[model samples]
Target: MTSRSRPPRLRPLLLTVTLALALAAAGCGTEPAPDRVAGRSSSGDPAPDRAELEARASAAQIVAEHVWVTEAAGYALARQSVGVLGDDGFGSSYTAPDGGMLQLSVERRPHAEADCTDGSAAAGGSEPLWTCERDGEQWYRATESGHAYAREQGELVITVSGAREKVDRATLRSAARAAHRADDHELDQVLPPAGDASGRQPVERGDLPPMGDGAPNNDVGASG
Candidate 1:
């Protein structure tokens, strides 16, 4: 009986601790359902569709002084201009007098080079007789016959789509080359040699020629 009396004081403290824990658990238990419902409602916000993205891409424009070139010589001959448009806009346009004028806009990526490379000269009957090159931030031009005399120069860059499902640079280069081959009447033989989209073609990631000092020597094959 005496020992039972001595244990009585600690029982009150244990009871208080138990009561606090029970209250906290009860407070936390019932609110989860309501919180989850609120979170779900907030998370269900809608996002922009495909059309919106396309529109945004279209609106972005170049705003800088661009160096454009129209080369009319060599294995790679075409007239095209590439320039830095402002801080964001970058575009290139090409024209073949007898054929069509095709223009393409360059997409901007963080810390990327504006690659222009040694393009093959426009073969005989080729619509465009000019070739252009853009590497890093410079653009150059040469005449069709000036290619051998002008030398091969420019950079080839890889352009990947958002999903990486399509390669724009490869597509553009291939189409350009195809146009050249068609003019030369060597389309079937030089191109379409049994290759799928996944297969690598002639235009691998080629390196751009080193930029020499002074103005680009475009005075090849001058009419004296």
Candidate 2:
């Protein structure tokens, strides 16, 4: 004479809920991998290896190994100018307080010791009093007003250049000496995230004809 009511059908529903809850708990227990490009981090860590750099760079469609940074005595990095050069090369500029500019360029190309005269044409219109010398592994090239130090490390060519009027020769040399591949922290500070929507996008003009060579038609129509 035991009149035991059958267990409530709600038991099945309770079991399902419990299973889902367990799964969610399990998922929450596991931590996500740390993000290396999440802006400047306070943690002191060593620079990442080439394989890691390649992964990070590949995500941003650039060459990670090409990203180099240098510290000059009084020059500060121009954050806006830290950008990719041709294809996957790296280029950045530093500015001094007195309106001086120091440029750092890194590229993956075989660099043979060439006479400084070969690059003299880069000076510009007038011929500059050019002087070239070898300082250790660096090819130091100097004009009457400006100077640049370029060195080859493996498959990369790193150069530090500045105007003599503002940045001193010693400062430029110091920077070149310090130039090295960027670490994870530097990468975070220098490069914008891959496909960062927050970045400024190129403005789309309605007048642009999306045909031909895609050049803007400036053939002056009626209005000057």
Candidate 3:
């Protein structure tokens, strides 16, 4: 069978937006500049990683090009929740003050009108899709349990959803429309900070004998 039209994966897109959520617990993640990947410009201003902003995309496992983000009235991105969907697909959660939540995901997959009935429109076939409506470029689907807004952007399907009590149809629709590829600034806020690379240096231990190469500090002098 011939493959459907899907956008070629863009490389060097995210530096990887793990949503590194701790940076942003409030307000759609943190506004910290993209420090890790970017460098200072000639004007001394911090600039995006030359590779992301200036170079052409190449393939990688992160496939950060598929990562998308959105904005809603009171929802803030839960950076820690940002993660890969299936393979390189993007997924994240947005939270509100009342403990309400919204989920947004972008997948490199296909969904047509027929998929709605064949059960391919949702998580393989796990999500019960009972209601389907086409509104302009979006396809609104509702199951007995929940509802969501979905649209096909290139070869990817972007979706937004929330519990019925937490969010309304209009809100989900707005989120889906607002969803866009994470830009350099957003990537910085969304991607988790990287850990220091591995080295031979070992952590100093409190129990190790200071004078001996391999001995335990067993002296319990004063206290014992």
Candidate 4:
């Protein structure tokens, strides 16, 4: 007599169990942590090298030339450059020991017209802006949180701002007046010309790495 055949379903059930166990074993293998990857950092990553910081400082200096500081005493400067969609710009911030801050930014657009008449006039007791006869070039001063000045010169637009109590209107005006177009050399340093190989340039300051909170001061202002 034939032995009672094991239930037909038993074979498929055993195969299913074996497959699931195999998958479970595979899942148990350790995965590389994200921080372990190159150019990546977990909370425990090491601080930037001295050379890197120095390079950034040098770049900042190139940008800071356009920013005029009335008094260099009791203040430290931090600067950064940004390039996007063929437009290039730089930003700088001067921070005083007493929590005072002044920010400046300059942007260059090849296609933009330097026209101030289109800008809405700032309101109510605000310092009047100065307009130049050339292409309606002008400066606008606003007293919101503090004092801010925006000016356009040819293809360059510059803006300066400072804390109301800490910085005076004249200082802002002076900075605006001091703003000048970045020369080709400075632009090349900040935004290297694209290489012919791929018609693309290497990554620039625009790719500034994320500096997490709790590091040094966050005194650098946002780019205009």
Q: Write the per-residue lDDT of candidate 2 for residues 76-154, one digit (tens) a residue.
A: 6655555566666776666655666677788766534444544344355555456667776677776665667888777
After superposing candidate 4 on the true structure, give the runs of residues whose Cα lies further than 4 Å from its correct spot.
1-74, 79-87, 109-138, 180-224
Ranking by TM-score: 2, 3, 4, 1
Question: For every model shown, what is its TM-score relative to the native structure?
Answer: 0.17, 0.61, 0.58, 0.36
- The per-model lDDT (C-alpha) reads 0.26, 0.59, 0.57, 0.39
The whole-model C-alpha lDDT of candidate 2 against the native structure comes to 0.59
Stretches off by above 4 angstroms in model 3 are 1-46, 50-61, 113-129, 196-224
Minimum summed lDDT over a 10-residue window in model 1 is located at 4-13
Worst 10 residues of 2 by lDDT: 5-14
The most accurate candidate by lDDT is 2
Per-residue accuracy of model 3 over 1-224 as CA lDDT, tens digit each: 99643222221112112232322343543322232222211244464583653222222234557767787777777655565567668777777666556677787865442344333335667654455666666767665546677777777877777666557888778787878887665554555544311211235888997676768777788978
Taking the candidates one at a time, how many backbone clashes does each contain?
A: 32, 0, 5, 0
lDDT (Cα, tens digit) per residue for candidate 1, span 53-117: 33323333222211122222111211112323335434333333232222323323232232223
Off by over 4 Å in 2: 1-56, 112-114, 117-129, 194-218, 221-224
Model 3 TM-score, 2 decimals: 0.58
Please tell me which model should have the higher TM-score, number 2 or number 3.
Answer: 2
Q: Is candidate 2 or candidate 4 better by TM-score?
A: 2
